[model samples]
Target: MQWRNSSRNYGLTSILLHWGVALTVVGLFALGLWMRGLNYYSQWYRTAPDIHKSVGLILLAVMVLRLVWRWLSPPPAALPTHTPLVRLASTAGHLTLYAGLFVVMLSGYLISTADGRPISVFGWFEVPALVTGIPRQEDLAGDVHFYAAWALVILAALHALAAFKHHFIDRDDTLRRMFGRAKY
Candidate 1:
């Protein structure tokens, strides 16, 4: 299928970044759920919490890169005769997902920093604190982060269902275009 945004199908860089972010997001979701089941005070939970923090920071970094890539590359064209309402909904949903991702990551960082913990990026290095030491603020940030994560999960499920609809029911090129393939 002809790309909607650019003339060519997505380049190698775009495809790689798309799939990489997808995998990371799925992994993060699993990790988040697992951490919720653990006792925060236990040693097992200690490492898991740190892993969560580190991976989250990494996701934040990657997301920033992804945004830049999206801006520069754009996405494939929408299906022909797509209604204005459908187009608007598509734009709104994508914007919400990106915004939610940023807010969730930022809240996590703020919560950890306020708790007097250094944010580590994948165990490689530490991120400087966005803000330090305020118990009330930390508590508030933690609450926002937790709820935002759940919102993301719900948004993702809807996004996936939409993609499936396009791929299966509509028998369209929406999914394939992103994967660098032309519609059959």
Candidate 2:
């Protein structure tokens, strides 16, 4: 497949980034939820958070790259079968998804770095905490991270449902395009 987006199809890079970010978000959310139940004696109690933070930092890098890639190679236009409302909703949904991802990531960063410690990403490098010292920063950022994660998951589910509707009910290529298939 092509490596850059075209007017009618998503290229390999876009598809890879889309799935990578989506899967990582869901995985990190699940890990975060599971980590909350661990007690002080649990073997994974400390390990899990370290893993979560590491993966989160990597995700942040990928997100930044994805944004740059998107700017360099914009996505294809909405399918012709999409109505005006559908097109608008599609745009809004995409924007909201991007915003929500960043919010969740940023809050996660704040929660991790509130103690003025750097986050180590899989032992590769450390991201030093550049912002700290606000009272109750950790607690507030934890709440934001928790709520934003849930909101992002719910919106993602809706996104999947919309793609299903376009594929199964509407019989359109909306879903296929992300796989680098195009109706055009």
On lDDT, the leading prediction is 2
Q: Which pairs in model 1 have colliding backbones? A: 1-182, 1-183, 4-76, 4-77
Predicted candidate 2 versus true structure: per-residue lDDT over 28-77, tens digit per residue: 99999999999999999989999999998889889999999999999988
Model 1 segments more than 4 A misplaced: 1-5, 39-43, 133-135
Top candidate by TM-score: 2
Lowest summed lDDT window (length 10), candidate 2: 175-184
Task: Give residue 170's lDDT in candidate 2 (0 to 100).
Answer: 96
Q: Report, for all candidates in order, the number of backbone clashes.
A: 4, 0
lDDT of 1 by residue, 94-184 (tens): 8998998899899988988985667776678999886875659888998998899889879988988988888898787777767877554
TM-score of each: 0.87, 0.97
